[model samples]
Target: MKLNFLTLTPKATVIGLIMGLLIVFLGRGLGLFFFFMMLWFLVLSAIVSFIGKKYKLKRKLFEDTRGIKNVIANGLWPFLLVLAYYFLSSNQFLKYALIFAFIGSVAAITADKFGSEIGVLDGEPIMLLTLKRVKKGTSGAVTWLGISAGILAAFLQSLVMLPWIGYFGSAGISMLWLFVAAILGGLAGTLFDSILGYFEENGKGNKYTSNFFASVFGSIIALTIFLLLF
Candidate 1:
């Protein structure tokens, strides 16, 4: 996540901008705010993946340079929620809730990335549900280190919303509850991703599919919490 110009594939760059533009069309305020956040997200994600570069490379765990499909897989849910804000009832409650949902969506993926990038190096993984010792990269397997990393990553992502707390607080969004939703929503999404790894193991889906739905789950969980509180 160096601030330097990371070599984005031409197609990925095009797709990213197109998604960003569409988001702007849906909500200019949100669109503008997210543009910078998206950049920061990208930088952090890449750096997280690069943390144990030589180790990951030796173990075949290194992340490849993400391309267009990667962008779409990660970007689609946030965009859909933005479209929901644009097309659905325009009440402040819903809009504000969706804001947390957007954060949750991004946080989920970030959790996954951080968890994997850091946790994989722990060298001891077990089945997610059974606790049976399993090899690294085994779908549905997890490590304590990974789980903690995921939670920490999600919390980190939630904190990004702190600066906006007062601005939204004026709009009836409880800064405390909203922050809780963001963190829990993110955690649920990461857990869901791990659960879905079973389906991935059985060839029901791939990493992209899991990532996509985990993001959706994060939004759903965030929205639920918002509705309950507000």
Candidate 2:
């Protein structure tokens, strides 16, 4: 049988393996200190993508050249930011930052999954910001179901970091922080994503730059909130 990796573009598969090795094993250490979240991220992405495609919830926001261009344009900053955080940070903060950064990235990507899948399948429209009625899949549009799903996806991602970031007994509180961070961050990122969708027509390049910055801002915001509350 053909290998699963063969199904992915070389760039995608290479980056995936490199990211996994670098983040989980080398950067964070292994066994007890392993950053297993990276593996979960990969598995979750595949599952979400497959399920999303099966549901026919794919948004044509980026089509053909548009999709490749958008992914490349928007992804660079997050990629570099994570790399810098891993390489440049002291051991103490590096672990925390990486946790926050991974959570942010997961929330950002999977927000699209929740928003698209829930919105497309739902009967009533939900507002992106206010939770009121709006057009399905409209830019800046959101639904209650979608937001809940986003929170679910984000929380799962956040939970994977517990061993690396918090104490065993504190897992309950950590769960609280993870839930709150993922839900709020995922919502904020989704809203931001919608805003990008709306504005890509006028200045896609500018939107690309802003996307990274916004994600950083969202990550910081989530981390800060978690710290303050817990």
lDDT of 1 by residue, 17-115 (tens): 888888887865667555544555576677787787898898887875778888888888888888887875268767777787887788787777777
Lowest summed lDDT across 10 adjacent residues in model 2 is found at 61-70
Q: For candidate 2, lDDT tens digit of each residue in 1-230?
A: 32354224455566555555555434433322333544554455456544545445354432111233334443444455556665755665555555555466556555555565555555666544455666555555556676676667666666665565555234344556655666677667766765565554345535455455545555665767656654
| Cα-based lDDT for every prediction | 0.76, 0.54
* Model 1 whole-model lDDT (C-alpha atoms): 0.76
Clashes of 1: 1
* Best candidate according to lDDT: 1
